[model samples]
Target: MAHTVTDRKKLLNRVKRIKGQSIALENTLENEPDCMAVLQQVAAIKGAVNGLMKEVLEGHLREHLGAEDLSKDQRLEEVEQVISILKSYLK
Candidate 1:
C-alpha cells in the first residue's frame, strides 16, 4: 500500500491489461472452437496474473518489510506477516 500511493497509475494499468486479457480469454472460450486457441488464451491470462502478483509482492516487501529504518521488532512482525502470506500462497 505504501508503494501504491506513488505507483497507483502503473499498478492500475497493469490490472486493466490483465482484466482485458481475462475478458479475451472468456470470449475465446465461448466462441473459439479450437482447443489450442483456448489453451493459449488461458496461458496468456495466467502469465499476466502471475506478473501482477510478482510486482505487487516485491513492492510490498520493499515498502514495508524491507524498510531499513524500522525498529527490529516492527520489521520482525512485518516479516512474519509476509512469511504467512507466502506460506498460504505457495500452498
Candidate 2:
C-alpha cells in the first residue's frame, strides 16, 4: 500500500520516540536507578510500542482490508490474520 509523505513522517517520529525511550531505559539500568523506576520506564516503553502497533493496524484495516470486497471465507481469513497478530503482540 502507498503512504503519503506525511504518514511516513508520522511513523518515523513514533519510531524516534520509541528509540529515545529505549535509550532512557538503558541509561536507567546503567545508572542503577531504583527498581520501581526502571520497571515504570519499561512499562511506559511497552505501552508506547503497543500504541504504535495499534495505529499501524488500524491504518492497515481501513486502507487495505476495508477497501477490498471478498467472500465470506476471505473475510474470515482476514479476521483470523488480525487475531493472530493481536495474540502475538499480547504474548
Q: Give the number of the best model, judged by lDDT.
A: 1
Task: Tell me the lDDT of model 1 at 56.
Answer: 85
Q: Candidate 1 versus the native: TM-score?
A: 0.84
The true-versus-predicted C-alpha distance at residue 17 of model 1, in Å, is: 0.9
Which sections of candidate 1 miss by over 4 Å?
none
> Which window of ten consecutive residues has the lowest lDDT sum in model 1?
24-33
Candidate 2 matches the true fold with a TM-score of 0.82
Q: What is the C-alpha lDDT of each candidate?
A: 0.84, 0.83
User: Candidate 2: worst 10 consecutive residues by lDDT?
Assistant: 1-10
Clashes of 2: 0
**How does model 1 fare in lDDT?**
0.84
Local distance difference test, candidate 2:
0.83
Tens digits of per-residue lDDT for model 2, 1-91: 4543447888788888899999999999999699998999899899889878977888878765686677778878888998999999889
